[model samples]
Target: MMAKYGACLLCLSASVVGSAQAESLAISALGNLDLSYTQPQRVASYEGSPLPAQVEILPGNDYWISTPENIQQVHFLVGQGQRVSKGQAIVKLTGPEVFHYLAQVEAAASLYQLAKSRYERNKPLLANGSISAEKWREISQDYFTTHLEYEHMQHFMERVHSTDAATDSLVVAAPVDGIVKLNAISGPYMAGDQLFSMVPNNSIRVKVNVPTGQSHSLSAININQCHIAIESLSAIAEGAFVTAWSSAVPQECNLLLGQQMTVVPEYQKAVYLLPKNSVFSWEQDSQVFTLSDNQLNALTVDILGSTPEQYIVASDQDLSQLQVLSQSVAAVKGIMLGLGGE
Candidate 1:
């Protein structure tokens, strides 16, 4: 009887051990358990710190002055930071070709004057029958040719005279009366090349570098639609519609030409932003692991919007109940059992 009882006890013990082993194996198959992670309700909470930038303003109507002749080796009209005006002479140029044209005009004028005198004298002779009609006609033709030549010479001289040599000497004038910003001196530049730039004062713009993903968000908003706060001046500037974007990833903004500025772009859309690292892809689908019943469950979400530092997840999940993993979770054994414990 004792032996039989011991055999039964041993059998029972073996069965218990096997059952426990089966249960443990089942739990291990589930992988790691999801822990409660702090998830912000709003997407803006996930946005990373704003990028640092210096304040910059917009540029007014400015232009670069170049040489008229379109030749090289011409002197600059003004030095850097020199004010100028419209139609004001900025640069002066003198060349051997200019003098050559002037001499040609003088010679042409003298010959034309002599021809005019002969034509005038023949006109009377032809009427009086002192000279034959053919001879008079020849003198008339000469007069016409000389007169044309003289007029051409006069026009040529006028062109030369229009060239400014002294005050407007080789200097470029501003198209508008504004500050002279840049004057490039001591360079071999071709004619029509930019020699200087001008900009009006106090034209500030808030330039921001927006990621490609966030480009659509910007489109919904109008230019100068909102006011921007300048941290340095503690002042607010009204936004204005400037120019459209140029590049996919706009690294620079022209708040001030050649200057850097910090800007915060306000989006019209309600975006659920999050840290870029917090989001992961699984099976070609975007997902975030959230803790439910003390176990991690892959939550598929639609990406409503995103920036470099954050992701905006669109989902129907009860956000109040869902908790995402802030940090990468470690592999935990028997995770399935823990989830199924309840």
Candidate 2:
């Protein structure tokens, strides 16, 4: 706080202060105002509040790559923040779980082979009525299903497979290009837990949560109308407003996953948007000088808040048809002094 403005004002009042104050008062009285017209315009609004948000990596068709089952002594080929290309090995896992599944698949494969041989041998026998036709059909179906299950298991090994005949370590590869982003865990991640997270190329979106009181404003947002600015990045992220709730909206943006950032998301409003200079605050109240019936009328207004470009005003009077002075500062003081403009 300053010691006092009185000393400065007194020193200047005789010459400079008198001239400036007179000029201000004259301008207020003459009512020469910078006037502009406005419509609802989807309730002219802008976003200002820098809210907390995180950078999320959205996948193209398949988003995430997780572990197959419980595995121990896992090693990640890619480190956090490292860019990985498609077909690159991402992680390797070793544990009894892998061997157990491998054994089951091998057993299934052997059974499939035996069933196939038996079907070949019995196909003619059944045709000749040497064996039951039902038995032949069952044998063929068994061979087909077992072969399918075994083939699927083989494909699985391409992801997490034994290093050698002993099945020491299973290697998993990246399916697409992405930057590495891991989930929370210490060591030996279990089945269904994320071993490594990859933020696929061009798959970043943000989830913005607005205050519950501003639910109405949130709903008015859309892909075409909404935009996002991440302050941390010093850049603007154009968004596709894909999902919305009463108090939140998910917008598509380009950013790294799990990155904490501050975002300003543009949205629509239902109140009056005024120039900041138009509204003046008094003791416990706010007022705007509007030209009504060719007369200057000071209208009381509720200021929801200020945005980057406009002040959101809620006025009981219809301001859509009214012209408010953008230079209302002097006019406000003049009105207080009973020197109201004509």
Candidate 3:
């Protein structure tokens, strides 16, 4: 709001009062200082110290697919990095294991059928007291047990591959629409190894590393109160709290899996978030100038934490008289000294 750096006699006007409306001070080669009232912005501060963190590519549960077992003669139907629709066929596979599994399933099916037939034939006999209750119960148990076994095998076979393969080989499809990992389906792979990795491509989180000595502060942080600044990229983002963890690495980021990072974790405590330029230091006291009755007064503020451009301060005084200064306040002490000499 400053029009110009209007000159005033320090000795004559420093202690005086007037009806002149509060006006901003503008200094050339400097900045403008607003005389308008501005109260300190109060916020919750985390006393928990900050520690090094890492930005990790967390695999979302949306559809993290992996190979179930050793697959033989695996051939991917899609190219690497190709977007695949949910339930779309992604791979063709064959293995001796599938045939062995199918044989067991067929055997279980035959036993189930025989037991079911015997149970049905005895139902009338048991009702007419032709068969003992104990015998009927034994037959029912065998039928149910075999039926359950057969169903289990059938379910396993259903997932052995997709159902639409033209050959005897098993076909596997993507569980969600995602880019196929080009290298995942070229050759046979063992069970439990990564088949492919995909991200929602944009959904990501930063995991901050708190040393064993400092992790005690983690309990106080909630998802919304955490902030992560990617040091290398100069990007900052809020964090969503995580309870569970995974080991899957990100497919793409200008980051390594083990890169260290910094996270600004916050907790609820009375404090102020202020621009660094607004606060000034004198001797041992860090203060900000507040205006009242057209006079400037300084209030001591205890700084709690600071970022490159902000300061978190803990103070006990009321902020009703606080004024936001727009011009450089580095010379505030010099003005105060001039007043003392008056």
In terms of lDDT, the best-performing candidate is: 2
| TM-score: model 3 vs. ground truth | 0.49
Q: Would you estimate the TM-scores of all the predictions?
A: 0.34, 0.54, 0.49
By summed lDDT, which 10 consecutive residues of candidate 2 come out lowest?
1-10
Per-residue lDDT of 72-112 in model 3, one digit per residue for the tens?
Answer: 76677887766567667777667775555556777999999
Q: Compute the lDDT of residue 209 as modeled in candidate 1.
A: 46
**After superposition, candidate 1 runs with Cα above 4 Å error:** 1-39, 43-64, 67-172, 177-211, 218-298, 301-334, 337-342
Residue lDDT tens for model 1, 20-54: 21112222344454433667455322221232343
| lDDT scores of the candidates, listed in order | 0.45, 0.56, 0.53
Q: Which scores greater on lDDT, model 1 or model 3?
A: 3
RMSD of 1: 19.6
Q: What value does the lDDT take at residue 339 in candidate 3?
A: 46
TM-score head-to-head 1 vs 3, winner: 3
